[model samples]
Target: MPFRRRQLLALGALGAFAMQAQAAEPAAFPSKPVTFVVQQSPGSTGDLVARALGDALSRRWGVGVVVENKPGANGMLATSQVARAKPDGYTLLVSGSTPLAFNPHLYPNVPYDLRKDFSYIAPIQDAPFVLLASPRSKLTSYGQFVAAAQARPGELTYGSGGVGNSTHLVMEMVVEASKTTLRHIPFNGVGPAMLSTMTGDTDLMVSVLPSALGQIAGGKVVALAVSGKARVAQLPNVPSFEELGIQGPPTPGSLVLIGPARMPQPLVERINADVRVVQQEEALQAKFREFQTQIFSGPPSAGAGRFLREYEEWGAFIKARGIQAN
Candidate 1:
């Protein structure tokens, strides 16, 4: 062959090799260990879910899936770390709606933008919140709670995990929907906030059902109303906010799986499909019920859209209510 002919054949061979490599990428994903950067500390709900997911994925892929707990800064630290990671599916983030949906609007200087910095892979679990009242407050029903709040206006106080927490914002939604005024008392954590409600330091408070189930079972606080559209089995007598004629925020307690932005579409689909399989397992289903959470199903883009919708919904509520993080 002549010099030009040889050169053309070499280029064509190289191009074909490159295309083969590109095509094999998704199938060859997790040739090594994968990491899940959990936004909450060990033993936290987020951490627990991440570990369970990691285990399931490890079993499915025949490769180790590691869970790294980077708890602090209201999930910003872990989230930002994942955001800066390479877009390969190896490094991922496990977090709740508070970080992806509520944090950017609450904190003025959030380092990462949900829309720009992450590829939403899937939602793992949905944990709904419950609105509880102290016995001293003499509130037993959602209707009475709303009536009392309206009657007392800003005098009735509600406690939350912190200023910009989902617990806080859910109450703000309740306030806005019921057209009532209630003072907010922010605490360092949900434990303290729930304790305050039990002690009558605050007349009412919001808690995720898993954390609140023990207290509700013990009758430490009155379960007035729950979040989500339907009543939960644990609190059978309590009505959901929807049943009480008020709409709560959408998917407020969903635990989501996400990766760095610009990940290849095939890899994302692979992860999403694997997650759907893992979530349907009987063992995982038992764990979900134990945690008082349910599966949130959808494609990868579903989580992305949910974050945007929630950000807009709670952004307005936070600004109007003058809520700020501590």
Candidate 2:
């Protein structure tokens, strides 16, 4: 009994030593440059938005901020990278509605359990959808787009970024609500779909504003309507789908930041605070608007909670639409 007690005491001492060693490790949380991984190609609206915010953070925090582009894999490549990253603050993600909200519904076997694998840092911004048609086409407004489509019945084609994307679902919901029919053209990306519209490869692309802005300004494509509650500031004259008497999905996509789950609450709070400050910088906001997007810096820890509700709602919506995850 005496020998057993000594052995037990030694084991307890070793455990204590290990705990203390871990706790004593210098908390130089971002002692080095931090990497912000994004699931978008260069020049993409999401990528540009991330760079703007990253520059601001670099200036304010005095620590180097690097933006890495990790496109493709349906954002799964970057999402998985951020999900499996250490809970430390060094690695982060400029997550969009793709990985944060829609992926849960679109992927049959999501690798990272959102609720369990992520710590939502802060809501970055909203990317509203715009329903646009080719300029050479006769369609002038949402009503015209719908009426022309109904007249031809599946003869009109609408382009999408890809399957399970916000643009795809937006068109689906709009067609279902307007009681009209149109052919669906799934493209590799928004750029390709928009190009198809410009070349008359497709009738229109229910894409985000950034994807269609240049062509709209060039008169190559027509500005149909914004798919939101209010008019976009960039195109003040444009009306919303609601104004066109068409109601579908509201607030199609947004950009947000999140880290791996089990992140220390203190570290999460530090990152959230710094990021919120960066999101509100006047210069950053200006650049964001240049892309026709808005920044969202909500309460400190509210992002995670918001994501939880958003995930549940988006999942239900996808299921209701009978959209398969594949």
Best by lDDT: 1
After superposition, candidate 1 runs with Cα above 4 Å error: 2-15, 18-20
Provide the lowest-lDDT 10-residue window in model 2. Answer: 21-30
Best by TM-score: 1
As a whole number from 0 to 100, the lDDT of residue 3 in candidate 1 is: 100
Clashes of 1: 0
lDDT of 1 by residue, 142-164 (tens): 88988888888799999988877
- Superposed by TM-score, candidate 1 places the C-alpha of residue 152 at a distance from the truth, in angstroms, of 3.1
Give per-residue CA lDDT, model 2, range 1-326, as digits (tens). 69999999999999999877655552466678889999988988888888888888888878898999998867888999999999887788888766667787887787888777888777787767777888768777777887788888989898888887777887887888778888888888778888888888888877777767788888888888887777887788889877877664454567778888877776777777888887767888788778777777885456666666667776777888788655
- What clash pairs does model 2 have? none
Query: What TM-score does structure 1 among the candidates reach?
Result: 0.90
User: What's the distance in Å from true for residue 203, model 1?
Assistant: 2.5
lDDT of each: 0.84, 0.79
Q: Backbone clashes in each candidate structure, one number apiece?
A: 0, 0
Cα shift from native, residue 117, model 1 (Å): 1.1
